[model samples]
Target: MKAAVHSRYGPPAVVRVAEVDQPSVGDKDLLVRVHATTVNRTDCAYRAARPFFVRALTGLARPRRAVLGTEYAGVVEAVGGGVTSFSVGDRVFGYNEGAFGTHAEYLAVPHDGPVATMPAGMTFEEAAPGTEGAHYAMAFIRVARVRAGQEVLVYGATGAIGSAAVQFLKHHGATVTAVCGTAQLELVKGLGADRVVDHTAQDFTRDERRYDAVFDAVGMSTFGRCRRLLRRASSGR
Candidate 1:
């Protein structure tokens, strides 16, 4: 199997495509012939050992795992014994998460680990990148306890997580306001944001209206900066 491997962490240049031994299938695992995978911020963060603390998991001086991709869409070529959830020829998409070994021609994933049949009408390329954004957005939505008719604001609303947040909030019937660069105002609106703020031309914090929740999807803003935007409880206290 050929995979993108990085023996040491530094920059994008450290990664190279090389042939490596394919993963062995465990009794609960499925051997997949990878059709598509996505290189996302998590991959870059691990590769660069950014924030410095990530080295605790990746490695102090080098990466623990040679292969770096986290998300993949592939077809099952062989299923290990006891694995009945998927079989040969099944199309699946999922993330490896902490294990992190999907950037290859073949990958072995446990049948029960985040793996799911690809939705109808979605291609491998389209489904692979969707998981990263969807996962983060779902986490924030769940933690915030977002509900229908609530007002929500998403900052940096054009990137992967931001765009997904806009759509997810809108789908749940929340009135979503998105902040992005001028070039992406219409793009964010198309994702179902009720209002779009151009971060370049305007300061969203100056707006008088408050929201049930304020999500800085890109980590570009802090809770202190957005506290004024969050709705306050009534009773004039």
Candidate 2:
């Protein structure tokens, strides 16, 4: 099998495709023939080893796992004894954080992990990115406990996480206000935000209206600055 292996990573140049031994299937795992995968901020952060915190999950000296990817779409080549949810040739797509080998042609993942059978209507590429945005957006909305009819602000509303957060907040019944550059104001509004703020032209905090929650999707704002624009309680980053 060929894979983008990283023994010690510093940049994308460090990663190279090479022939490696096939991974053995485990008792509670499924061996998947990867059809598609998505490169995301997590992969870049892993490669760069930035912010220091992410290294804890990989390794201190080097990466614990050679391949760096979380979202994958593939077909089950074989299933372990304890697995009954999927069979050989079943199309599936989901996340794998512990065994991050989605960049390769094949990967072994625990059946009971974040992996899920791909929805019938979705394509491999479409399903792959779902894990990251959906998972984080859902978690953020829950943590903030967004209420119906309340004003919710999503900063950096054009990015990966911000795009998902905009919809999630709207789905939760909050009157969403998305903050973005002038070019993305319409795009964010199209994502179901009730109002859009062009951050280039206006400072969001300077606005008199206080929001129930202000999600700084890009981690640009601190807690203190967001507090001035929030209604007593809010969450960011």
Q: Can you tell me which runs of candidate 2 are displaced by over 4 Å?
A: 233-237
Q: What tens digits encode model 2's per-residue C-alpha lDDT throughout 1-237?
A: 999889885878889999988889999999999999988888888877897887887899898888878899989999999999889999999887666889899999999888888989888888888788777777888887777888888888998888999888877788988899998877887999898888999998787888887888888988777778876655443
Q: Which residue pairs in model 1 clash with each other?
A: none
- TM-score computed on alpha carbons, candidate 2: 0.91
Error of 1 at 104 (Å): 0.8
lDDT of 2: 0.85
Across 1-237, the per-residue lDDT of candidate 1 in tens digits comes to 899999998889999999999999999999999999999999999999998999999989888999988899989999999998887999999988789888999999888888999999999999899888888988899988888998988998988888999999998999998999988878887899999888889888887889888888888777777888877751110
Residue 207 error, candidate 2, Å: 2.1
For all candidates in order, the CA lDDT equals 0.89, 0.85
Q: Which residue window of length 10 is worst by lDDT in model 2? A: 228-237
- Give the candidate number with the greatest lDDT: 1
What is candidate 1's local distance difference test score? 0.89
